[model samples]
Target chain A: MNLIGLGLVGFSALLLLLFSIAKRKSPVKLRAIPALTRLYRAFGLSVEDGTRLFIALGRESLITPNAGAPLSGLGMLRHLTERTSLSDRPPIAAAGEASLALLAQDTLEAGYQAAGAGEYYQPTTGRLTGMTPFSFAAGAMPILRDESVSASVLIGHFGVEAALLADAAERENAFLVGASDDLSSQAALYASAPEALIGEELFATSAYLGATQSHTASLTVQDILRWLIILALLAGAALKLLGMI
Target chain B: MRAIAVVLAVATGLLVLIGYFIPTLAPIQSMILNWAIILSGAAALVGVFNLIWVHWGKISRREKGSLYSAILLICLIATLIFGMLLGPDDSNMRLLVNSIIVPVEATLMALLAVTLVYASIRLLRRRANLMSVVFLATALLLLIASATLPFGEIGPLNNFVRPWFQHAWALGGARGILIGVALGTLMTGLRVLFGADRPYGGK
Candidate 1:
């Protein structure tokens, strides 16, 4: 097998092994991510204020390579739905793509079923705002303005258009926590969002927020792999300096 | 049942994942990817219908700002009919896309640049941290270095500093983020492949 393929299989095997082990063990202590902590606090604030919470699942398509962000975002959605399912106004999810929107709906329904509040679930709570980036931003702007949303969590694959949504949420005085896998979007979020998740933190949402064993194990694996990569890079640089290669 | 979905997901995922390495399995991967794309496209159509249902409900109930809903419906139907009749590549459809959609999107993008500037300026006011100061400084320096100087270009600031910052510092950070994202993507896909995470419907 080629290096790329070998790497993929090796990593998958490692992740699966880690996941199985994690499932059998007690919860591990994870480093606190301020943004995730803020998000959880926002959920409580939404409940206390009796205001709606809005989540922007972004416009990434599930069939494409860019599905990672939305998938990670859904993990957060699943966790949020469990807490907010019984609220008078449950969290509303707005997605850029249709499949993500449908999945978000299913996730909400599943959350309600798990909570034994399936009758309270409404398909309308999960909305497919638009198919395109700017259109999605435009579609979501009205909801942010009119829905009395107290907290807005935007996590997914966002482009430069994320600024528009962040600005809208700011205008509405909503508590905002934004994260994205896109660098430019992350930079914009750093500036726009009061709390922003940087780099690998987006992937750790399920671990920190949901406390899922699989997600936590995957995160631990990611950390170990990241350290290994850093060591490799450093060694390569050192070898080059010594004219070894 | 959920078990069937998990089995299908694992099977298809292995085929596609293995296909990435083995040359002979490429065709199978391509076919599966194509099927997925088609299914996603069909899902998008369902989303459009969902959008229509939502707006229709708003209009029917005479909800607040239903005028906007009515306008959206009219525009959607008009564009849909126009595209269907003349085809997507036709001059009329292109005109509609170029003249209306592009300009609105461009305006929003332009607005984003201004918003970024505003946010950068206000960063310190919101949180007076070292990162905020560094962010503001870098943004201002980048803006100034990239701009025309009217008289002439500054030497160190325009040449060495900006280039080093852009190519070395900025590029390094971007690469780091890319690596992190790549790792995250692999783990997420692996989760689905192993049936530990079922995003299709299961818990």
Candidate 2:
């Protein structure tokens, strides 16, 4: 890794720790529904009873220093599953990566146990949808059309092919909420014009939705470090212009 | 277990981060990178197994498009056997994959370019007012600029076509967008850190 890459990762880790601490102390509430959330809810309203909440997670680039998006997205799935347990409804999670699918199973099981709905938890229910971006989209899109999907949330590392799924959700009048920090993926989901959280925002989703200490700690470290970096860059530029080195 | 995972995740993260800044840490960085690749590769194998199991069920049940499943199974087994037994240096299996898989994947991706153009055309056809017209014009110009053109001097047109569209306008806008994205990412991170949002399990 180069300096820029190191700075990016260290800064991200520092922020993760900060956010985690912050989450431990104070949990933020998103009182107003984000536009995508609202759109998804509206889509859900038209669906039939017993329709499941479908979530597709893509782990396209986990090797990259920033694994925040998929990790946080997993956290969100945990939150969602807990919420789902309170109701008579069941949700289906379609994971793009097999490892994530296994994690999702555990997370969902944990959520159910926490909510005292452990009886309803099934390993087969949580599925590994597909591997490639196109294959996953192709597989998940059909669920939206043929099966009654009340609400759909795609949170993780996805590619432009997400557009197909988003479009399918829209056509079915199913609620669709998407969050991806990757720039290329965001561009593909234009019709939904998803209210995406860029880069570190993906890391913050768990804290944003459910206040985790790890997240808070990271967030805090990031803020302080970023400001320092900005200041240093400005000073350096000024020094260079003045030939003071 | 949770504590261990957190500690390990953070430790690996820090090591990788430091590896970027210090030349001496390059080996550590390389090791981390290797681990990441290994982990993902392991995950891919899991995915392949899942794919095979799912498709095998479809085949047994005589599900629609089971022919595709058959093709997939045949290819998967054939490729695995050839590559594993004959070795990449000796087998023609690698060539088959390169010729077939690469071209098909590339062609599928090329379809996206067509989709974008089609979308633009659809939007233009349903123009209701001023905003639509501007969008249509922007789309058209962007398409024209992105299309392959020779570097040979077509006078002022070439200058305007490449620089204004590609370098000055697009590049500047892209750079600005990236910065904005970075800032937005930073804010979201801050929000999480400050406990303004709670998406995690333990409040």
Candidate 3:
């Protein structure tokens, strides 16, 4: 048994529990995510402009460690699908994996069902563009260019290939808000996307965009844990300087 | 149905988590992971079929770019036939992978580098923030540091500053992001396991 992992998990569980209790007593205020805010505005603009909102669900597999970002993307998708259900052209969700595409379709259907528009839910709106990153980008570029997309929200596990899609959005003059868990992709996105989520911010979509209570509590826990980690790193540096093991 | 999915997810997740720490449960972990791999492979086939269907719809409807869709189908069928008839380990299959796939992927990667440079130039115009400036400057420094100059062997800039920045600053930032991603993954997984966040059609 790995004692460190166990301890970490235990600590996280405690923080989660405490945060949940605190959240019940008082609402938590999180720092604004500009990208998410821009995305919300883009949704409204798409409806007004009579254009489609494009959402890239990314290239991560459902069972990998990288799935976290795409799962968060799905969380945001739930909110987006609901808000844009009545639009003439609903949000177009493109994924690199079939499972994600299927889930996205289901999410759209569920959103429509919730909004009393179940009959209008079209399966083609959520599509699996390609299984590979570059192919996915290639397939999605035409949609961004031809469909008159008002905005593009890319939240997923992208590599260097993210630049291809981001560039396409720029050429089409679509508002872009992008984020990824991969550091290099995040850096690339920071340059390409007018508003980009950095590092941990990608994980906070549920709290910032969806406003889910548990997700808010989870964010609180994440913040506390980050502060703890920073302190520990600082302490370790000090100890190393002092010649202590 | 949702209840069954949630229950199954929770149970399987717990088992996997437990298997990670217990030597006795390692086999169970492997089994589950193998099942996941198989499922993913099947899903990949589904993705291929979905791609074909989408393209077929465009062709049937005589969409504006239906010609491109037809080209895609022809290439796909040709590759599939060659792959099946000759087998994956055959010389022809290897030649296709080496000649076509490798070069295309390499070209795309090369394009990515150029795109990143263009994006960096536009970063200033886009945001004009301190972070943008820092990002651009760092990128310039790294690019210059890694480049092979005509006057070889620059002392401090090449020897100390470049290595320090690459190893220290870049590595530190990457590690920080990795940690955050790891923590986020853990939290998200736990949430799913506990049925708090459902990606599978539940509230």
The prediction achieving the highest DockQ against the true structure is 1
* Better lDDT candidate (1, 3): 1
TM-score, each model? Answer: 0.96, 0.71, 0.95
Compute the lDDT of residue A83 as modeled in candidate 2: 69
Return the top candidate by TM-score.
1
In CAPRI terms, where does candidate 1 land?
medium
lDDT of 2: 0.63
| Cα misplacement distance, residue A53 of candidate 3 (Å) | 1.4
Worst 10 residues of 3 chain A by lDDT: A205-214
Candidate 1 per-residue lDDT over residues B1-203, each given as its tens digit: 88888898899989987887878999999999999888888988989988898889889999877899999999999999998899999987999999999999899888988998888777888778999889888988987888888988788889889999999999999999999998898788777777776676675
Ten-residue region with minimum lDDT total, candidate 2 chain A: A190-199
lDDT of each: 0.86, 0.63, 0.84
Model 1, which residues run further than 4 Å from truth? Answer: none
**iRMSD per model?**
1.5, 5.8, 1.6
Error of 3 at A79 (Å): 1.5
Candidate ranking under lDDT, highest first, comes to 1, 3, 2
